[model samples]
Target: MSTTRSRYTQTRSSTISDDQIADLIYKLQQLIPDDQIHTTTLHHHKALNTKVLEETCNYVRRLQREVEDLSQRLSELLQSMDNNSPEAAIIRTLLMSP
Candidate 1:
């Protein structure tokens, strides 16, 4: 298993002045139609959902690996018990019981 770190960082600095922001907004209002904005929002939401699904799959796979390891260890412990031991015979009986 391997992990990767994102190198891209969110910008904390805002160089745009208030006047520039107002100008940009005014231009955006003129350029982007109201109907298209809804489509844009939907696209962003789908992208977010994809990321969530990917993360969930990774977690499930890791848990499955841990469960398999625990099962193998349990099997080994049972096999190490002598067949003549009372407790071991009881365990075998329990396992074989219908």
Candidate 2:
């Protein structure tokens, strides 16, 4: 019975894998000075990676929500149209006319 439309938008953006981020972090660690590199730096990289992953997951969830909302709306519309309705009769006549 809910008619509120979903505001979610589908994004076709590609996501990077955690393994790839790990590889990049490993490579970055090798580039930094041994003395400058510490646990904090690794932690920061991990935090940033987690943030990106969460964003991607949220984006997917939003898209799914939008799809589900649209599907529900379509189902509601179809349910409202019985065979005796004018629109339904028109649709039937159109199909049979051809």
Candidate 3:
């Protein structure tokens, strides 16, 4: 029947989406910096998953911005200093050492 076929298709689509969400959440868990997302009781809730994914994405974006700002500042500092100066040498050495 048409109705039965439609229902089966819908169920298949839903299962696929659920599997995709589970994969995303697993990757996110691995990327999380801390052991804080306990999530033992709330993983089945769609709203909670959305919230967690949003927060994680925002946090990573913020970190990216911070790294960019710091790199720019460091570049400026190096550019403003005399290339042969002791401070520049020390900075270069530190960077190379670690």
Candidate 4:
């Protein structure tokens, strides 16, 4: 399996334990102004969501750039191949035959 797939599987299988949840709830309860908790939590979640989206976009762009670089290198290598060389001639013949 791919490294990314394995990591995702591992993360998916993991869950927050009940003790953690309880601790979180206890902490939340300690905060002042209970009426503003909901709004504060929503804002915090929104900020996290935005950060995740930005990171995902950056990763995608990096992958795209890597793919483009690989494509350019492959084109350069192909261009460097001697047309008169037996291997190149054979490859051209095989490609044309198909």
Question: Which regions in candidate 3 have their CA more than 4 angstroms from the true location?
Answer: 1-44
For candidate 1, report its TM-score: 0.45
lDDT per residue (tens digit) for residues 28-94 in model 3? 7566444454566445454566678868766755665565555556566777889899998887676
What does candidate 4's lDDT look like per residue over 1-98, in tens digits? 13323433444455445476456555554553545548759667656655665565566556655655554554454467885888766645543473
Which digits, one per residue and each the tens of the lDDT, describe model 2 over residues 38-63? 76687776666567665766676677
* lDDT for 93 (candidate 3): 74
Highest-scoring model, lDDT: 3
- Where does the lowest 10-residue lDDT sum fall in candidate 1? 1-10
lDDT of 1 by residue, 1-98 (tens): 00001100111122334466456545644554546446759667555555665465556556655655554554565667775888766765654577
What TM-score would every model get versus the actual structure? 0.45, 0.42, 0.50, 0.46
Better of 2 and 4 by TM-score: 4
lDDT of 4 at 81: 81
lDDT-based ranking, best first?
3, 2, 4, 1
Candidate 1 lDDT for residue 67: 53
Give Cα-based local distance difference scores for all models. Answer: 0.50, 0.54, 0.59, 0.53
lDDT of 1 at 60: 55
Best TM-score goes to which candidate? 3
Return the candidate ranking by TM-score, descending.
Answer: 3, 4, 1, 2
Q: How many clashing pairs in candidate 3?
A: 0
